[model samples]
Target chain A: MNPRDEILNRLQQVQRDETLPPPWQSRRDFPELAARFRQALTAVKGEVHQVDSLAAAYDLTNQLLRQMAAEKVVVNDERPLPNLPRLPHITYHQVGQEDETLRAFCASADAGLTSADAALAETGTVILTSGPGKSRLASLLPPVHIALVPITALTTDLFTWAASFNRQLPANLNFISGPSKTADIEQTMAVGVHGPKRFIVILYA
Target chain B: MSNPSSATMSQFRHSATVAIADIQLQGALTGATNKFVNGRITALTELPHANALRDHFKKIRSATLANLAHYLELFEERATTAGSQIHWAQTGQDAVDIVLNIARQHGVKLVTKSKSMVTEEIHLNAALEANGITPVETDLGEWIIQLAGEPPSHIIGPAIHKTRHQVAELFSKEVGRPLPADDIDGLTAEARRLLRTQFLAAGLGISGGNLAIAETGTLVLVTNEGNGRLVTSAPPVHIAIIGIEKICPDWDAAATWLALLARSATGQPMSIYTTAITGPRRANDPDGPEEVHIILLDNGRSQLAGTPYEEILQCIRCGACLNVCPVYKKAGGHAYGSPYSGPIGAVVTPLLFGLEEYAALPQASTLCGACKDACPARIDLPRMLLQLRQDEVAARLLPWRERKAEEFAAFVLGREGRMNFFTKLGRWGQRPFQHDDGLKLPVNVGDGRTLPSLAPKPFRQLWDEGAVE
Candidate 1:
């Protein structure tokens, strides 16, 4: 017999008597969504800044980039603010324009600025998906990741998100909670191992 | 009904001895396991329904396993619809052959990999090397061990046993330069610089599946480091070798599983990256692998279904049992001589591989029940361990000396007269080895545990002499 048939036959004959687990619902609630998101994100060494408006968020992004002395930034030109006003101090290389140049640019770029599709207030997770102009590298390759999150996109948790998720999921959807980190060497915390060293979230109400 | 041993018992005891005697290893294990154990406790306490979540996770795993065939078929159908090519492997070699053939077809010269215990279990890297494909491990712990030519020492943190000095030394040798041991960030930065090239140059990427959500035909991978993202996104072709039992019926089950996994493993609300791959990159998307493949590996996993050991299939590979296990804290991961270690490894290695070959594994535990408590799935490992010991006896896998001692003790402890006589005999025989308050056996026995000598006077003797209160 073929391997699949043999394995299936073996497993089919031996299944025990058990019922499926009862359906679950998320009892978790966030009366203060942005505050909870900030607390949770900041606990993992991720930066969280709440803004009163999108204009304020944009201003903070420019100030933060200028402070870092960032020379180049790869911005994902999709959703929330597809037309982020480029500043003189930072050279913006928008994604999906001649895609081959992305890897090298992201490798050399000082940071990647993007907007999330949704945010999880319970765990302070930002959900990003790949589509027309949202390149995966925009949130990945650079040394720093700056997310512009709108409070209207916030959800309670994964359970709450899954309950109403009806659209087809993209090939790549990432739930990122913090910056890259590892404690492999003698249990010492070392951030910025591979992906972004600094994860800054600008939450706009 | 007898199955003979392929791996001798002496090998098990010897490695355990070496691990116990190495002060460096002892210190590392204590530090790493203690922190993980304490962190898990603190993290779980923050949850309003931590216990309820664990129980629900247990139910989900149990229900999934009991209906493994149904869930697997559903997963295969959905994943196929999503454009993932699913391959079935009845054995480890079969899995390796599938991967090698794929590599050969793509003319892959180099492969970048995220941390996958399944690949380590099958020794996939060695096979890849023999086939002339250089595989680079991108996870920092995995990379350190790969560079040093050592297997992973822990399930979550593979190189926890190695000091920073050792890692610095390994990094220096690899780069042909000296590096300061005190600067961990420098070492990590150097590793990142070196591996970044591998990600861009590699022809293929491989990872293990944490959850194969049958609901949406998704593969969920959780990783603290961003290597998982690079492995899945950077390469043109990607392959995931997943154990057959890693399937969840739907997103609800998968969500609950995720809720308990990172907390139990590394005490995080969630890992840094939890990437869900539905299929190959859409034509409109600018990034991600062009081709996606899933290999469902069943190397002795299906055989445990419906048996007393079926609960072992419920393991999530979180390594919580290891952190809370006293024996694992002492012997470390190397002593098990398997990719898995600690209490979970103790029960799992023997059952999956061969009962006789790994007969000594079941004996490695203290049957403390802490493993069951610590397990996210609440698998009763001690119960399975007892059953394994019984299976060992039935198969007569124990050595002649051990069997004789057990048989003799059974005979003596079975009756009042025999028990009384042996009690006296043991007290007389204890003199030679008796020192202070403990009995020092002639042979090198357990790992630094003391066996107290028998009491000076028997209670029955005192009662007969009217000296008891």
Candidate 2:
């Protein structure tokens, strides 16, 4: 028998006294989903700001772009992101416009902007998917990452999120709680090791 | 057993003594483990129904393992449907050969890798290097150890044993520029600058999966450093080397298991990034790996099924047991001399490897049951350790002196008359080695252990005199 057959055969020979585990139910109740989300996000050194409207969020993005002295940013060619006004000084490129340029931009880009599919309140996590316009690297490969989330996207936790998760999923889905960090060096917490250092979530109605 | 393994018991004793004596290593080990233990407590206690979740998760792991082959077949079908090619390796050599063949076919010269204990166990980097491929470990801790020409000391924090001054020196050598010892942020920046190019330029990327979900045929990769994302996405071709036992039946089981994993390991509600990769990049997808290969490695894992050691297969590599282990805290990770360390390592290593060679590891623990308490899956590590020790003794791995001593102890302890005689004998014999609290005997029970001196009067004598009323 080949390796697969042999391995599977060995495992199959074992007598199983198995009981199916109970299905997970969401008993976690967050009184204020958005407030708890902000607190959890902020605790991990991520920034969260609540804006009244999408237009105000765009305005805040512009202000943040200027404040951070960002010269170039990469954004997913998706809704809300495409609505951001074009600024002359700060060049914004749609991720995956050109494969070569996308890689280069991710290498040199100062910030990445995309809209999260869902946000979990308990851990302050954002769910991002990989699809036609949503490049996996858009939220990765930058010093700073800015996410646009709506108030309605907030869920209780991962268990709650998975309970209602769509059966037809994307090629990739990421549950990111905070900025990329590491405590590898002498157990010292160092932020922004690989991905974005500063994760800013702009929540709008 | 190899020549190196012949002296396993003595080697463990020697290395443990050295590790305990090294003040710097002792400080790093205790400091890191205490922080992890404290964080795990805080994270688990804060969550609602945390204990219930753990119990449910344990059932999930057990059920999944009981039907592992079935779930693996299911995962293969779904992953294949999602555009991933699944390969099974019966041994570490088979896994390494398959990976080399993939790298060869791709003509891959530079390979970027996320930190993976499975890869470490198989010695993938050595194979890649021998085949003229440069493998770069992207995780900071893994990279530090890779640069230092040492194996990972800890499974989670590979470089936890290294001090900042030591890391700075390694960084300085790598970059050919002196970096400040105290500035960790600056060092991290240098690593980013260094590894970013590797991720972009590398032709192939290799990673280890935390779990292979049979529900969607998804591979779950969890990391706090975001290296998993880059490794899987940056390179054109991706390969994930997962152990056969690392599986969850479906999304529901996976979700519950994950809830406990992060808390048990890092005390975070979630790691920075928890990615579920179904397949290679879709046709319209903007950016992801074009080809994804999943290698399911058995390598002695399947043999443990239905055996006394089957519970060890449920380990998630969370390193929780290491944090709370008293032996691990003092001896540190390097003393174990394997990919795994601490309480879990003692059982898993010997079971995966041979008990005769790693017999000493089973004796490394104090059988304090801290590991079982800290375990997310609630694996009975202490019970398994005792089993392995029994197997070792059965195989006559114990030295003649030790075996004879044990036999003599059994003879005396089994009979009341003999026990009384031996208690008096021990009391008289222990006088020279006796200290304030216990006996300071020259003999080592495994490592760094002390025996409490015998009582002034045996229980039999005290009872007869009515002193124990």
Among these predicted structures, which one has the highest TM-score?
2
DockQ of 1: 0.78
Task: Tell me how large the interface RMSD of candidate 1 is.
Answer: 1.3
After superposing all C-alphas onto the true structure, candidate 1 shows an RMSD in angstroms of 3.0
lDDT of 1 by residue, B115-173 (tens): 99999888899999999999999999999999888888789999999999999999999
> What is the CAPRI rating of model 2's predicted complex?
high
Candidate 2, residues A88-190, lDDT tens digits: the string is 8988878657766787787789999999999999999999999988888879998899999998999998788888987577889999999999999888899
What are the DockQ scores of the candidates, in order?
0.78, 0.82
> What value does the lDDT take at residue A121 in candidate 1?
89
* lDDT: worst 10-residue window of model 1 chain B: B1-10
lDDT of 2 by residue, B55-138 (tens): 888888889889988999999999999999999999999999999999999999999999999998888998999999999999
Error of 1 at B224 (Å): 1.0
Clash pairs for candidate 2:
none
Q: Mind listing the fnat for each candidate?
A: 0.82, 0.89
Off by over 4 Å in 2: A15-17, B1-7, B424-456
Residues A97-123 of candidate 1: C-alpha lDDT, one tens digit per residue = 878888888889999998998999889
- Residue clash pairs of candidate 1: none
